[model samples]
Target chain A: EDQVTQSPEALRLQEGESSSLNCSYTVSGLRGLFWYRQDPGKGPEFLFTLYSAGEEKEKERLKATLTKKESFLHITAPKPEDSATYLCAVQAGAGANSKLTFGKGITLSVRP
Target chain B: EAGVTQFPSHSVIEKGQTVTLRCDPISGHDNLYWYRRVMGKEIKFLLHFVKESKQDESGMPNNRFLAERTGGTYSTLKVQPAELEDSGVYFCASSRSSNQPQHFGDGTRLSIL
Candidate 1:
């Protein structure tokens, strides 16, 4: 079974604090890893897609890096508006269904 | 272009009642997906539709849930005899291709009594 696990169920950070959210996965074969940001009462918004180990993508204050077994989403100098639940998901390449298996998400609270 | 849209931003109903959620995919998007997040849980896939045909429905919880994508433009998901466990946020997403990234809607929050 393909499973995705996220650590630090909840995190509180002060303004300008930097941290990383972890997403560990065990899949038959990873086709792609995805990162999404979800606010309360809203759906998830796409952030990045990592296809291979050593690959990294960045946007604004957020950066995403992928490894062979896990991925990290690093937030630099986060603000109150950046507070949201960060989700990680993995897709298996060999499956007839391309449905993604998602982590429970890390709830980030940035106090300003 | 407009993003995926879901109707009835929120719904409240009693157990055993029927509720229907609707989704409008982005123009030209061929792949539509349905997912839901139960309380304190991860988002789980419910189904996927390619045009007017269901590409996969393995994630569907049970026979009580029925989904349709008639005419290949809009889709609807109906839950009959809803259970208390069905209370959650239902999300709709669409992608131009099956392998590409998907765009999501604001989601509809369902509360069962």
Candidate 2:
């Protein structure tokens, strides 16, 4: 079965605080792993997509690294504006139309 | 580019009533998807449409839900005889292709009485 689990269901950080969120997944054939940030009352916003283990991508204060069994979203020097629910999803096939299997998500609260 | 758009950001209806939700994907985006997040549950895939064709609807819960994309343009999801279980946030997303990152709209919050 394909499953995505995220740890520390909620996290709070002070300004300039650095931390990392974990997303572990189990799937038959991993095609892609995605990271998204969602604000209250709005839909999710795309962050990064990792295709293979050892691959990494960075944007502003955020960095995403992937391994065979899990992925980490590193938040360096976060600000209150960065508060949101971060979601992790996995696509389990090579087919172009594979549906995403999403985790429950980790809510992040960054205090200024 | 204009992001995906959904109508009636919120809706409240009685049981057994029919409610229709609409989604307008970014222009020229060929892949559109429907997802639902029920209260206290993970967001689940409902179906996918490539242009005007239904590519994969295996995730659709039952026959009461019907989705259509006429003229390979905007799409609509109709829930007939809506049940209490159908109450949730319905999200619409689109991308240039299925393999691309999907952009989402502010979901429609549906409440059933």
Candidate 3:
């Protein structure tokens, strides 16, 4: 079974602080790795999709980087509004088997 | 474009009662998915629909859950005789294609007492 494990189940940071969240995975053949941000009582919002190792994507203060075995979401100078649960999911195989196996998620709280 | 939307932002019910959740995917999206996040657990895929067809449903926990996407425009998931363990957030997501990024709705929070 494809599995995703996210580190630091809960994190607290001061406004403008920078840190990175880690996601480690094991799959038969990784088709894609996804990053999502979820707020309290809300569904997850897509962030980035990493298809191959050494690939990276950025949006505002968030930068997502991937490797063969893990992925990292780096938040640069985060604001209080950035507080949310960061989810990491992995899709294995292809075609109709596009289901995503998600991790438990990392809860981030940024204090102003 | 409008994002995916789900009805009943919150629902509270007693055990053994039936509840039906609805979802309206973004226009032009062909792939619809159902997922659930139980408390203290990861979000898990329940099933997927492609243009009104059941493409994959390997993750469905049991026969108590039934999902349908008639006409391929909207979808519904019904849980009969709901159990206490069924309390959680049920989310709906849609994608343009199989490999595209899936967009999610705000989710329906179900609480069984």
| Best-fitting candidate, scored by DockQ | 3
Candidate 1 lDDT over A1-112, as tens digits, reads 8999999999999999999999999988888999999998888899999999999999999999999999999999999999999999998866456787899999999999
Docking class of 2: medium
User: Would you give me the overall lDDT of model 1?
Assistant: 0.93
Return the lDDT, model 1, position B34.
97
In order, how many clashes per candidate?
A: 0, 0, 0
Q: Rank order by TM-score, top first?
A: 2, 3, 1
Each candidate's chain B TM-score?
Answer: 0.99, 0.99, 0.99
**Residue-level lDDT tens digits of model 3 in A58-87:** 999999999999999999999999999999
A81, model 3: CA deviation in Å? 1.2
When summed lDDT is taken over every stretch of 10 residues in candidate 2 chain B, the lowest stretch is B95-104
Tens-digit lDDT track of model 2 for A34-92: 99999999999999999999999999999999999999999999999999999999988
Any idea how many clashes model 3 has? 0
Model 1 lDDT, residue B43, Cα: 92
**Model 3 CA lDDT for position A51:** 98
Winner by lDDT between candidate 3 and candidate 2: 3
Question: Which tens-of-lDDT digit does each residue in B6-86 have in candidate 1?
Answer: 999999999999999999999999889999999888899999999999989989999999999999999999999899999
Q: What is the DockQ of each candidate?
A: 0.76, 0.78, 0.90
TM-score of each: 0.97, 0.98, 0.98
